[model samples]
Target: MKETAQKYKRQTASRYLPVGAQEITSKIMEAESYGVSTKHDGHFYLLSYDGKKATLTNHGGRVIDDLPLLKEATALLKGKCKTVVLAGELYLHKEGGRTRSFDMTAALDDKSTNIYFAAFDLLSLDGEQVSLDIKALDQKLNTVLSSGKSLHAVKNSFVESRKDIAALYKEIVEDDGQEGIVVRSHNGPTYKIKPLITLDAVILGYAEGQGSRAGMLKEVLVGLCVAKDEYILLTKVGNGYSEEERKNLLKELGKKKVDSGYIEVSGSNVAFTMVAPNQVVEFSCLDVFGENSKGVISKMCLSYKDGTYTANGKQPMASVISPVYVKMRTDKKPDTNDAGLSQITKIISLDINASEKLDVKKSEIVSREVYVKISKGAKMVRKFMVWKTNKEATGEYPAYVYHYTDFSAGRSEMLKKEIKVSDSKKQIEEIFAAEVLENVKKGWEKVKS
Candidate 1:
């Protein structure tokens, strides 16, 4: 189950576009034949049945063996096939409220919460990959799955024209309360169409409100990390929080105030009080744009140091559209891998460098040391090199590279190496000292090259 989860995680997530964007949706609707399925607001999981036993694994590699849904699936498929795997959303239904991801998360620990799985795709059957079309796959699921409360097939509709696609979107998304619709082509690309999109970013600053909301925060400035301690200003979110929440956030951010160097306003003439980048927040927006309507890059990158933010003259990757505050993610941190540009690029296709390509300086080697130590008639060599990556100006590369290599003629592997990157000269120097102290012992002799 862990191996299968890792394999699926490597596959690119399906691309998506705004449902109202006729320019993009029109092209997708032109596919020869397609099927539409409701985009459930739930967690993604895979169900694998091996004729005798069944297992369920979430995208994050957690195995769920105790859900009643798993037991039901195993019994239904006992004599049907040797093995089968299906992919779908794991959601919990509410009696009078709409299905939401947050609600599902809150009920995960409640054994009596009635968890359910909506199988959408037939990935494999009888231990062989299934390459059937959407219609064929739907038929197979109907025949094999039969009906059950805890486990069932996701409902779908087949369409051939733009008119039909638009109608389905209206019915499923706007009227039926589903988050969105996913349309899969018979021979082309698959698309996820939605009215709004969500993003996770780090808080950079805040602005005070006025008039009726004068005592609270009016809006919060947010950015996405492009590198270590470097963030690209994305957007300001003002709506979707209560008055009490606004007041609490203002008091919380006041202690983190810092000096602003590049940005000054929220694009609306309101002055900003900059703060440290420490909080990870989730926000919903209508869309994200790499360029403004005037075809100009509208985002800027900044570097933070010693409680200050300064402009870093590098091309920005993106900016948000009409963002609204949602919730704080205490489990996440403001780092490159968590709050990075790849988070946005993974969901939607954007030409971030459409205006102009950026130029970067080549890396310069600053120091090199090679040492040899002879032990018991065998020779072992160690090498250390340090280089400055002036490419940080491009907002795409780290500031320095510390590379270490070790080779031994007597070992089966013969070679072992490690490469580390950093944005601080002092930190890199300390790393160099530590490496030398650990590897350079009594019999080692420095060699000039």
Candidate 2:
């Protein structure tokens, strides 16, 4: 009787969380598939739906102020399935509002943009919510997805062929929507946030703004791409292009404003009145939210900011891009370097937690040996291999890596418990040489835990 009473109280408390931050609890989630999801309440944290009443402060409002997720949320919820503890974005998707989606619905205050819950992972399901068993959670999630509810949950995928999907990506981009693709692992219930390496997008036109906006022409077109053809519209931007670039674009685009005003571009169902697709801008962006039929791309940037405007390089203010300006890029076709590893890395950074997405088997100091052009007049030391990719030799992948400058004394302790430090007697003697040498080697540390 005491255990039963305590259970009831605990369940009731699960309805509310402290305001500012939230943490994953020990709740065991059974097997269940997660659709890309969005949290409806702006709150970064939430109370589990206990089928009682709204316990969260905003019961119906958001505390986290998250934009819509770029991917759709889905899951099959019936049958003799295991209890699933799902983790994902919880959002409100107004019912019966196909065209409006999250952005339009929220902004327009359309009641139709009802709340929605899209889980991306199965933390636990069917009487098992493992606190640390990610693999178990993943498997359970897949089991639930097999129930067949995903076909209608949100964005649907029916594989045809890789060639077909690639072609479709170009059509969506031509439509002036988001730019990229989502390749699901047929081997498992996993979806990767991928960037286009050779995709196409329609040309909408350049933005009309100032200062950094001065001169040579650039663009700001409403764009889209594919799944088989994933096309999503990007967001509001007043920065990016320079004034000179804008001017060049105006002069060139003026000639394209046709009698019909409907300028045909690349990618999906996208069209621009004044801007034409004569010139393709190479770049990258972040994938945000998506509707059943549309997708979203945010934080887009030109790979090359120095290149001349293809539109009107000869017109007034047709300033040539400075070489130092690091020709954002211009060597290959716009589609050649579509979204690739670089793109996927960026997207993964945003959607998945560091611990969840990255391989955490062993953490350690990462080192790489590359020759920097030092002053020829200065003494140089023999170079040695510090870090190397096993990919080239062992056919294995490399880890996501970064470096930091350390000038501070041992203000912070070096690598701690769970990881050890080693040095040969001769190596330690060598490291004891000059203070400058010790300083450099001392700073070169790693994280192993």
Candidate 3:
């Protein structure tokens, strides 16, 4: 089949660009309208169909063959159009209503179902390329695919202010667990805005690649070092590495390779090459999982303990799911990672307490008065006040119950009915000695086990 003269032009968005909600709102207020849509994390493609046959092409306009989704799509659009090209993302929708890129890649081998084409733009119509407006393009695409079951137009909204854009983005990303959003200017080029959550983890090992990347490092096993010379295996991150990055990582791993240690390989097709856990690499992940529904310490690490994987006496390692290798950190050391694990443990304890059917938010240790300290240990202690907005009430209230974490001991405590803001030095000391300190120590003893 012959391709259209108007090929797909990939749009790019940079983090340094002025594409935030405020900037977008300002642009819209200046008589410039923009369409905001969820940027689906999937393969970009342009589907073309003539009266006789249908073909799928990538961003470069080259025809893709033997793909089941494409074939099904061809059948869906076989007689629908004389000649038309639809631009969109090809992805696999999970049963739980999530779009996964890994599953989309697996769909290339006919190993996946529920594959979809999220059509966004109408590129061509009746074998002719036309430059219709965004709204017109959307209307045309929707009209054409009104009866189709597999293909659907991408949903978008027109926004005129920062608040509108922000609300839409939050609804799509945070509430829906989606990647992010893409904002297309009415008369200019398109721009993307997505949240990129990154973390610093120590490199534990490397997994061998297969096929075109065989013999090279396919994925790097990374972990969080909770103590000196102590590390917990997190997850193997393979995506986001370029060809040059893979080669450079191979060289670095060769220099850092140690005796094959506690590195575990979950699959037979991949081999693990153990390395010294000294190099710290930064990774980007989708979302962090915590113990409770409130998502406390959810930014620290991703959990893989869905009862499938375990380590260290059946204890699951705090891992980042769908970790994308970003870059190696030369300035940060492995020991600095302890605070994250400590925070995770603290959140876990809080979650445990929350699971006991306690109203954690309303439960506060009110202080009678504020006091200042001047001692050797005072220099090491950081104090801050947190005010939480009471949605049911008219004003914000201070969160008197504070979390004091001992990173060195890997524990935390939530003290109640102690350390009042109105308490004097003697009263504070007496309270600490009489109840607070001992209660905290006892709390740690329970949490540590």
Clashes of each: 0, 105, 6
Q: What tens digits encode model 3's per-residue C-alpha lDDT throughout 1-449? A: 22332224323211113344334455433426667888766666677777766666763345665555556666766666687888777777664465655455446667454767888877678877768767777778778887665567887798765567778878887788776787766666666655655777777777666688765668887777655555555567888988888987887786654543122552433335666666888887653433211112211121222212212221233433457888888988876453234533421222222211112233333322222323443211222222221211211122222222222212232111111221133443454344434434321322111
Pairs that collide in candidate 3 are: 367-421, 368-421, 368-422, 369-421, 369-422, 370-421
- Please give the ranking of all candidate structures by lDDT, highest first, separated by commas: 1, 3, 2
The candidate that wins on TM-score is 1
Candidate 2 least-lDDT 10 residues = 312-321
Per residue, candidate 2 scores C-alpha lDDT tens digits across 40-141 of 221111322222211211222333223222112212343434343344333444443221222423432443233444333433345554443333434554
Candidate 2 error regions (>4 Å): 1-84, 91-115, 119-152, 171-176, 179-181, 189-432, 435-449
lDDT of each: 0.74, 0.29, 0.54
Q: Least accurate stretch of 10 residues (summed lDDT) in model 1?
A: 12-21
**Candidate 1's error at 394, in angstroms?**
19
> What tens digits encode model 1's per-residue C-alpha lDDT throughout 1-449?
65665465446232343444343355664777888888766666789997788888865567877777778888888888899988877887765445665456446767444677888877789989887788888888877788666788877799887678788888877788767788778866677777877888999988877788777988898989988998987778889999899999998987787765443455445447788999999998865544332232446678999989977655546666558788988988999777888776654334445333446456688778899988889999999987897876755456776778899999976776655567788887887778888989998999997
* 1 against 3, candidate with superior TM-score: 1
Candidate ranking (TM-score, best to worst) = 1, 3, 2
Top of the candidates by lDDT = 1
Give candidate 3's root-mean-square deviation (CA, Å). 23.3
